[model samples]
Target: MKLLLTSGGITNNSIYNELVDMLDKPITDSNVLCIPTAMYGHPWVGPGVKAWKFISGKEENPMVNLGWKSVGVLELTALPTIDKDRWVPLVQEIDVLLVSGGDALYLSYWMKQSGLAELLPSLKAVYIGMSAGSMVMAPTVGEYFIGWTPPDDSDEALGLVEFSIFPHLNHESLPGNTLKAAEKWAASLKGPGYAMDDQTAIKVIDDTAEVISEGYWKLFQT
Candidate 1:
């Protein structure tokens, strides 16, 4: 699995482009399994994965015509049915998983309820994650006690990686103050971690990780 972790994807297309470029073949030949409900403030209530359109340029519309097969959260969580016609094949034979940006807590919740949260980490396909999607793979998250939302005991992570991820380290590209903020957050962690800035990403295959992009890839620890 390839985890491409980014800060925030709503305003940037670098992560998406990178994943698309990394694809083994043209997108037309493959299907994409996208879960955008991870981010807080999602479209639907429970397990809000349907909110990816905001950043995908298809806001209010779940389906995007990218010339590839897609199974999105919008159609997955409907009460009546699981939408087996679209979701089953995507999950069983899709090319890759594309996780979009959102609050980490919400994302984690949906993954747990849907059961895909655990099954995804071990897949043979490409796994592309940005922001909250990547954050869940870390050892821990800034939940109830810390993070974008109030903590909840039920909110746990998939544990794909052994470290935690800190996004938007500089407070939205403000600069100068980022280091100070990162130092504070890093000090709070139990082990080594990363504070990735916007436009920057961490690409990990197997157990090796390479910092991608020119922005800061701050290493932190108390």
Candidate 2:
């Protein structure tokens, strides 16, 4: 399966080339599945919902101007929370799966619960992860949360790659409170981690990730 993982979004807001290149093929007639982490507030309501409608070509969103068809929507809160009996079949048709940004620890918990921990790696389509999405893909996310939590119970990511990742390292516009939280999280780390600032992303095509663009980029190896 081909994979394209973007940290956070593209460009000043999100990087477009990386995301566009992943698709390579045209999107007009493709089957894409966008699974949001349970940490997200609403499933199919508000802004996310509105945008999804368009991506799915439902006419509810302006993005329909772009070619997209939402085939499946999965919200994984925990391992046993969904009706698995019906989902196994639906998961097969997905051509792309996108994971949004959120708490790395919490997101990892939910990915395992949703059965994706076992399924996603083998998928034949594209795997697109943003922000924390990129962080958790690494074997162990280093110095991720500068806040309170248990030991490294949730820090052992999915082991998709054997490296630690840090997101939004030096975006000056970010609120001081959020930056402080990250600083606190980084301070508590027992080992090394990679820090990525906005306008930057580290693309992991195989086991190796190629850092892209300009920003605060570093690799902390223990």
Candidate 3:
């Protein structure tokens, strides 16, 4: 599997190049399905919903700048209520799956219910994840604040990658997401993990793995 797990959306040349390399084709040639389902989980009902929806609109979409000719948003939670036969084929045809940031557990829940988790491994697309999207692809995610409280019986992710990703490390806006908090979280984790900020990404192509960053990041081990 090929995956480019990013803390932020693709915001730099290096990250864009990494994605192009992973796709083995120009992004213009790729059919990108941008999943903004995770962003749908904001706790507040009225204004919060409107806020996230506005932030996730076409004008503000990160995928738009990628130059992909065919870019569309597919909300996982909306799948079951719609025409599955139509949407599933559309999803399968994409060359890249771009997942956006929001509540990680909420995203995971919908992915599992919507059958995306089962389809992902076999797709020809590269999985591109940003923030919450990146975290849910991990075997388990060390908390970075997505506001969803899991039931006592649940908290698992897709397990697409072995270790958890703690994104937005030391980011200015997220004051509580300090390296100190990261260290404390990593200390309790069962396996290795990574703490990355916006300018960094973890690229994994089957057996090989490496950190590609334009900003600071770190590997944490138990």
- Score candidate 3 by lDDT: 0.78
Candidate 3 residues 1-222, lDDT tens each? 588889887867888888888886777788777787787775542235543442344434354456786777777887878877878888777888888777788889889888889988877788888888889987776544536766643567888888888888888778988889999878767888898888899998884679999998989988
Candidate 1 global Cα RMSD: 4.9
Write down the TM-score for model 3: 0.88
**TM-scores of the models, in the order given:** 0.72, 0.71, 0.88
User: Per-prediction RMSD in angstroms?
Assistant: 4.9, 5.2, 2.7
What alpha-carbon RMSD in Å does predicted model 3 have with respect to the real structure? 2.7
Clashing pairs in 1: 37-48, 37-49, 38-107, 39-102, 39-103, 40-103, 142-146, 144-150, 144-151
lDDT of each: 0.60, 0.58, 0.78
Best by lDDT: 3
Write one digit per residue (lDDT tens) for candidate 1, span 1-222. 767676654234555566576677877777666765654434332233345354353643212345565544432234124644645445656676767656666666666666566567566667766667778777566432144442565434667776777776675434543766666666666666788776677778787877676567677765
Off-target runs (Cα >4 Å) in candidate 1 are 10-21, 40-52, 55-89, 143-156, 171-177
Model 2 Cα shift for residue 18 (angstroms): 3.1
Worst 10 residues of 1 by lDDT: 41-50
The true-versus-predicted C-alpha distance at residue 150 of model 3, in Å, is: 3.4
Per-residue lDDT tens digits for candidate 2, residues 57-174, read 4542112233455555666763376577777666666666666555666667667767878887677667766666676676665554422232545557777775666676655555
Which candidate, 2 or 3, would have the higher TM-score against the true structure? 3
